[model samples]
Target: MYQESSFKHDAAPPMEYFLWIIPTGRASDAYGYSQAKTPTWSDYIRETGNNGADRDDFDDAIDFMAWFVYKTHKVNSISKWDAYAQYLNYHEGWGGYKRGTYKKKSG
Candidate 1:
């Protein structure tokens, strides 16, 4: 599945391409930027609700992924292992991970 995303495993600039792929694998609806049941739109999901727009889902996902990595995770240092860790942290907020839903359940 990793290679199917068409992402190089060890990118030079350190992009966790697999992170985005995981979500796509789980939800093809991600490609349409459709939130399935949530009311979230890429254009309005930001905390301020005024800093986003209807851009490509993959690009928006990448942007949000970076936000999760450098901001939410407060990652003082990055490593390959961080990609997998932060992916869950992004999927479920850091608090959600502590609550075990992020690490335990599929939903």
Candidate 2:
């Protein structure tokens, strides 16, 4: 349930992502952490390149994501919780997400 844009490491921010960008960062407040705010690619600055130039593939990402979903508070213990809820918790702050803001969405 990880989310991210398709912007490349060296690509300039596109207009479509402007609304997703927060103050000097993405909606998740992940600025310098992610390469171009590409959601699926987690943060690991001081590395070689985008998602790192070395370690090929999503193994690192998958491992980290597993830990994130299982270790993060609130999102883990919520009843009937699933990847969708976890995604909401991840995108919105805990307080905001716990308010059930997404329940009103048309989606």
Candidate 3:
């Protein structure tokens, strides 16, 4: 998706944890943009925070999106995806997360 690519290029590279952020951005965008007739994953990333003072929240959104994508696409096993989904739920209070698998979360 275009949005996924934008988040990867625009947001992921600047972070100390680029791998972590990409999937979060993707998942958050997937959920947040679902209502649109033509939703973009990037729009979801953009919508997660205000212009300022919510950078942490924005980061969390990115992780959430990434987690969503990881669960849905990259891994082929339901058990693995469920574990990831649980991890995201548990880590919602923080902006950081660890990847359970090494595969890139997006296409």
| Top-scoring candidate (lDDT) | 2
Point out where model 2 deviates above 4 Å.
6-57, 73-76, 79-81, 103-107
TM-score of 3: 0.20
Tens-place lDDT digits, model 1, residues 14-67? 223466654223332232322211233342355525365332444554454454
Could you tell me the lDDT of residue 14 within candidate 3? 24
Tell me model 1's lDDT, rounded to 2 decimals.
Answer: 0.42
Leading candidate by TM-score? 1
* Residue range 1-107, candidate 2, lDDT tens digits: 22342322222333345456644533332322122234333433232244452113345444444444554453447433476676666555355577877777785
TM-scores of all predicted structures: 0.41, 0.40, 0.20
Clashing pairs for model 3 are 23-65, 23-66, 24-62, 24-63, 24-65, 24-66, 25-62, 27-65, 27-66, 28-65
Q: Which stretch of 10 consecutive residues in model 1 shows the poorest summed lDDT?
A: 28-37
Model 2 reaches what TM-score against the true structure? 0.40
Ordering by TM-score: 1, 2, 3
RMSD of 1: 11.0
